[model samples]
Target: MPRAGRPASPLITRRAAADAALSLIDSGGLDGLSLQAVARVLGVSAPSLYHHFRDKEELLTQVARCFLEEIGHQQERWSDDWETRTIELSLATRRVALRHPNAAPLALRFFPRKLMLPAYERSLVDCPYPPQFHAVILEAVEKFTYGSALFAAAAEAHHTPAMPPVDEAHFPYLASAIAAAPASDEDLHVEALRALLDGFRVRYGPRQR
Candidate 1:
């Protein structure tokens, strides 16, 4: 049975439900998540969850926005070189994804939707490049970030196994790199992210090589 007039505190109702949903993702991978599960955890009717978020997609978007807002908060906290700030943003978000592996796939798309646009918009607004040329810079940066985030999230969700041991003689370079660098899945992912940032610097940073 259920007992409810509107919650005594509407904001608490919404935040409690959202946090519960995120907690469920933390406890059980995304496959284990459902709006009903969130409502049950929060001791509310599922309709109440709907009131806060139109659908699961909106819920996911809100979660992703929460993640972006966290990044913005961190950026505000530190004044640092832009490259370091960018790395901190990427690595911190990766840690957040690892913490809530279930919700990551849904959350990853937020980069293109909300994160990158304002960044590119600000650059276009401030930089010397013409709009057409700035679009090139935007395109290059997005291709890397979008691809890397999705790939890392999927890998973590799937618990993708490390590259299997292999005959080094057959694939010399890859084998040597794997053995010498010895990437845990997370390490490979972070390094790959750094590589993308490096590419962007060459293409878009001052004194491009």
Candidate 2:
């Protein structure tokens, strides 16, 4: 017997580490997430995770990258019209945020630019704004999408209503507006996207053919 070959160390791939971190986030939220926690999930020592992720921040960045990748997949089926695509992508982002409320904030802190550049380039192909203004338009859309998703996810996770109850006599107009608002978060997101796009169109006009 060849000296009972040293027991092989447990394998831990980058994808596996990221998956474990994401699961930890999903089950317990970010406060509970740690390299040690992820190692525990993978049944490996904390040092084992270091082979793939340098630190918890790196691991969390990978988690955010993976989350954005899900939305990227949805982009393949988006409408050809830029405005429509904007709404579709925004809603898709919102859906992912809602699904991973605990991990959603990572998007703000660590955007995976390399993973998203291709999709961003593609959006410009049919965009109605000039190349010079593409950044402005896209940035506005992206900011709104991220901000809206963050707010919506937090509210949903805490079981908070979009509009808390208000006294009708004290604020009749506001109360009436809230009463007439769309009943679902997605509906609200779409309405806001449309309004933002409409403003962009007005300011930029269509790109010169």
Candidate 3:
């Protein structure tokens, strides 16, 4: 939608401010953004923002919560392989973060709000894994998802390339694995996760002996 008029009222005023803040962060990194910046973009007094938010942290919390809620909402009707739930959710999260790459880091973790946490809990409850295993599995998946995206995005956008390495002797399997799946971040994340679960099954899943 085009931005061409004043916000209709207090309700939209707050949402307008949030949308402006998102744009500011996307244009300039989060470090370059500020509440005053958002307020200016919204054509409102900086202090007026306080009418809707207690402080920058409060505003950021709202922004982060909104992103998480969007991610949760998008996955509300998923019907894919149950084992792939975490992977698909991680991908959905990446898609959300991609929309606000500058704020991607902030969207890296689940919002801690009661309303948001319950949604995550509900997803876990529906997963095939038991609670104890689900927690461990999801935690590991989220870490890889966020961490890979961070490094990958930075490397692609700003970092210089490093020389490729060559290894042979005792690292044959490691080399084969890398060759089998290329070094692209998402591919690496998926391959690593698959290897992890495969290893888990072999080592711990109802030992065949």
Candidate 4:
């Protein structure tokens, strides 16, 4: 008979369990990640997970921390311009989220505070944008990136939006803009970022542009 508590296998470590949980998220998203599911993936019992993590919340916290730590280390080389560095940081963050779409929601939901690394925070402080706009820009970038990641993930899963056929006469301008918009994900992201950054330039200065 198996033990009443703790993992059955000696090889199962905290890192291993976390990795397995992340794999589950990547494959089935946050809804698919549970202690039982992780245990199933690792060929162990659900109770075994309690050995490394006190509960589901603690497990998620660890998972988010791991991803945040990885993101922290994935920074680009420092640039002379703080604004340039800030944009580069946004792109880097978007790239990371795109690479882990399912995991993005978990990070967004449970650990919003941990999303922005310290170094990036410092760069934003030095940025020419006023203090009021700092929070706005950061939140906007994060929301956009997280939404984009979900869109990309859905696309990969062959989920497409069910938009009714546009009637030009009924909504001419809206239809025209939609028809003219760039279809590629990266293009849309860049366009949105430019528009947002342009607003900052108009209000504060052109340093971000």
Candidate 5:
């Protein structure tokens, strides 16, 4: 378990400070995280935090990097089935975003693309498809995963709109589909992902047995 309070000593390192900031984000979203707020959580002078992070932007960037590292860790022992690997990797990304919805936007938007090279490079090495197909698969899956994850996070952070009554004469099928949709955002995302994966299988063919 993460420590509940400020560290006992004055020697609060950058990692510890980031952890504290993340905790604040977990509880209250991005609005809750600020250098001054983190310092208070750590029971240290606000100026003290500057020793570890040059500014709030730097600290936030670090937080984003941390989550990417976590996603990388989650992929370590994923299944060999290529489709399964895609699903698990997407879910792994979703799990982190859900966990830190407030901080997730920052990571999704500002986390350096170069930092992702190691993980995606490994995917190229392990993937059986041609490089072009591999790139297509990756891009498609990332679009689905990140777009769904962002929508999920945003839905959690805000109210879901109530559907207006549909005109049966004009849009019956659309209304019926909306009415039958899963209430949970996570469940909806799963169904969407499966559909996307199915499309990929049809278009690109199955991975090697």
Candidate 6:
């Protein structure tokens, strides 16, 4: 039999590797991820992964970049209205985080600020806030959005109740507040965002410009 040329090395694109890493993260979280694990998922040897990723850390960084890219894509539909865009972007972040609760923490660990800055600058251009307050408003919105998404993801993963059991006798006020609160995290998240945006509008609305 004619000697078969050595089996062609499986072609592994950076995107494919990153996606496989993300899948591994979705199933097993950051802890269970390894170059070896990703390679297995791609049906290649661990060493082959080195051709694309120098190390596990680089692989993880790429995973985080990919995760953020997904959020960016989700936000592309945002309208030109600044307040509406803010709300849409925040919700999009939360939606993606909920989809991959296991990988959500990577967003915090390896935030690719450079990749995010351009979009933020565009948002600032559309913001009604005075020039001086643009940076602050942007920072505040981003901080709140990321924090809320992370908390929501953690709560979802742990099956945490929105309101814990409290004794009304000793903590009547707390109990009353809990009773009046929105039952679902999604409702509470929207309510809080609206309240936040309202405050921003009052403090930095067109009048301030």
Each model's lDDT comes to 0.63, 0.86, 0.66, 0.71, 0.78, 0.85
lDDT of 1 by residue, 76-103 (tens): 4533455555556666666665655666
Candidate 6 lDDT, 1-209, residue by residue in tens: 44487556546878899999999888877888898888888888899888888899888788889988898788446687888878888888999999988899889898888888788779877678789987788878889999999988887766785456999999999999878988778778878998999998888776753
Candidate 3 TM-score, C-alpha based: 0.73
lDDT of 3 by residue, 106-133 (tens): 6644354566566467667656554567
Tens-digit lDDT track for model 2 on 39-105? 8888889997888888998998899888998887865566878888888889999999999888888
lDDT computed for candidate 3: 0.66
Pairs of colliding residues, candidate 4: none
Name the best candidate (by lDDT): 2
Q: Sort the predicted structures by lDDT, highest score first.
A: 2, 6, 5, 4, 3, 1
lDDT of 5 by residue, 10-56 (tens): 56887888888888887888876789999899888999998889998
Decide which is better by lDDT, 1 or 4.
4
Model 5 steric clash pairs:
none
Global Cα lDDT for candidate 5: 0.78
lDDT score at residue 20, model 6, on the 0-100 scale: 95
Report lDDT (Cα) of residue 142, candidate 5: 80
Better of 2 and 4 by TM-score: 2
Model 1 pairs whose backbones collide: 30-102
Candidates in order, TM-scores: namely 0.71, 0.88, 0.73, 0.72, 0.79, 0.89
Instruction: Select the stronger candidate by TM-score from 3 and 4.
Output: 3
